[model samples]
Target: MPVLLYVLAVAVFAQGTSEFVLAGLVPGISADLGVSLAEAGYLTSGFAVGMVVGAPLTAAVGRRLAPRWTLSACLAVFVLAHVSGALTDSFGVLLGTRFVAALANAGFLAVALSTATRVVPAGRRARALSVLLGGTTLALIAGVPAGALLGELWGWRSALWAIAGLSAAALVAVGRLTPPRTSTDHPGSARPRLDLRAELRTLRSPDLLRHLGLGALVNGATFCAFTYLAVTVTDGAGLVPSLVPLVLALFGLGAFAGVSVAGRLADTRGRLLLDVAGPALLAGWIAWAALADSPAAVWVLAPVQGALSFAVGSTLIARSMAAAQGAPTMGGAFSTVALNLGALLGPVLGGASLGTAGTAGPLIVSTALVAVAVGLRLVTARRRSGAPAR
Candidate 1:
């Protein structure tokens, strides 16, 4: 793998830590700001909203710039946003900073994934992409736990400061390590006939839509359960407050392992079977978690859930890149945007269920969504086979 993969992975790790650290520190943030837990939840929702809007917006703005420069600039912005988040005392300012940070983050990941594919040999593309995305797992394994510990010791603000420092390190790494620009017209070259109409035309392909729907379903179910993991572990499973981050770290380790294995599987076998199986497995695991009240059970299940939930990232992403035909960048961006959309909706659905039905509701609802998704995948497969030949 190219050394740049490690560089981009570092940037991604920083971004992922910033994104998820808030969950572990939610109680601290709520207490510090004198806000309710529900309101503090905006931190997660705000970031998702930013990614949803920012992914395409930033991609469009950076279209003319070199991918390397675009990535570096985004990391710099991420550093600034984390600093701003660390310094802000007001809830509104902290939320706004997170949003800004997410904008940069969205652009960084989208461009980095596309560029990773471009820099590697065709056969090694999936592995390169997996290594790049594995940074998120690393963040969960290391950064989030560290941030949570920092929050527990120094305060949530201090945790944000640590994240800022990581972002700064990533900015420097990307600046020094990202390869030089090879084409000003590279984006155009990838999609010479690109336009809103042309993009929409591609969407009309039922096969492509099926694959995208699978991606969304898998992600949505995963995020729904994941968003409230801290709450579930603390309240539902009766774990102590201090141990949540440690469990989360364990979950992250599982995700890292899952992504590694899934990447090779996707490259060797097709993604469709993995797509179908992953969500099914996740649903079962989450259901088991909901019923098991033992802390030991929770500990064992956390990693199992994480592994199953994240197993699809590389496969789904590579599938989308392939489905995009020649427009890898646009395809990469769209796939990410779809994933963000899932993140956005997942929490809302989970939160609503939690409100209406209490602790077990979210997992039950998540399981239902995954089952529906599996059925959709079957229907989608049948439809693809029955469609008139291109």
Candidate 2:
């Protein structure tokens, strides 16, 4: 992999940490802002909404700019947003700042993925994309936990300041390491004309939309279990409250590990990886729901589910990019859009399941969602093989 791709991952790490660390700081924020916990939860939802709106809009706008410059501008905005968020007194101001930060984050990721595809060879594109996305998974594993500790030690504002500082460093590294904007285009040509109507047309494929839908289903199911994983571990698995964070970290570690393995497989054996992981995800969820009462089984199930889910995600991303080969930026942006849409729906469904069907209900919902994805994948395979549709 190119060294600059890793630098892009660092930038992603800063943004990913900023986006997710809020989960751990909700209590601190609610206490400080004098808002109810439910109200403070809007901050998270607001970020997801921003990502959904920002992805395509940013892709369209950034299409006119050089990829590195677009990435740089987004990182600058991200840093400033955090600085403002850290200093804001009003909850509304903080929420607005988060929305702005998410816009920049969405732009950064979309450009970064598109740029990685351009710089790497055809065969290694998926691996390159995976290395860039690995930063987000690593943030889930390490950054969120550390931010939670910092929030406990010095308050939530401290976490925002730390994120801003890291973003600034990433901004500097991006400027130093990434190739110039002109390098992304032809040897001596102006930035390509960004025809909005033409670009939008590229994303209108039924097949592409189906795959994107599959991605949303996969993400939604994972988050359905994850949204209430803490409760499930404590009440269902009989683990102590103190062990919850450890188990959640285990899930993140599983995601990081899975992404790493999937990154390699995507480059060399993508079809085989997809074939195995989709069914494995359904099986993992089945075991999770069936063995919810066993602490040991829960420990094993949590990471397996996480790994299989993320491995499937990496493959889908690569597929989406390939499917939208005519407009790479839009393709990359759509992946972000799909994942955020899933994030938004997952919590709602999970909360409902928890309220009505008890702790294991979310697990069952997740299993069913992954099963849908499995069925879709099989249909895609059959279509490719010229076999009759089921």
State which candidate has the highest lDDT.
2
Q: Write the per-residue lDDT of candidate 2 for residues 1-390, one digit (tens) a residue.
A: 889889899888878888888988999999999999999999998898998988888888878776778888999999999999999899999999989999999888887877888787788888888899899888888888888899999999999999999889989988887777544432354456546676568778866787688889999998889878888899988899999889888898889888888888887787788778888889899888888778998789878877888898878888777777666567778888888888888878888888787888889889888888889867776777785321
Off by over 4 Å in 1: 182-201, 272-276, 279-283, 286-290, 294-297, 386-390
lDDT of each: 0.76, 0.84
- The Cα error of candidate 2 at residue 78, in Å, is 0.9
Q: For model 2, what is the C-alpha lDDT against the true structure?
A: 0.84
Name the lDDT value of residue 119 in candidate 1: 78
Clashing pairs in 1: none
Q: Model 1: per-residue lDDT, tens digit, 36-55?
A: 99899889889988888877
Q: How large is the C-alpha RMSD of every model relative to the true structure?
A: 3.2, 2.3
Return the lDDT, model 1, position 109.
Answer: 86
Which pairs of residues collide in candidate 2? none
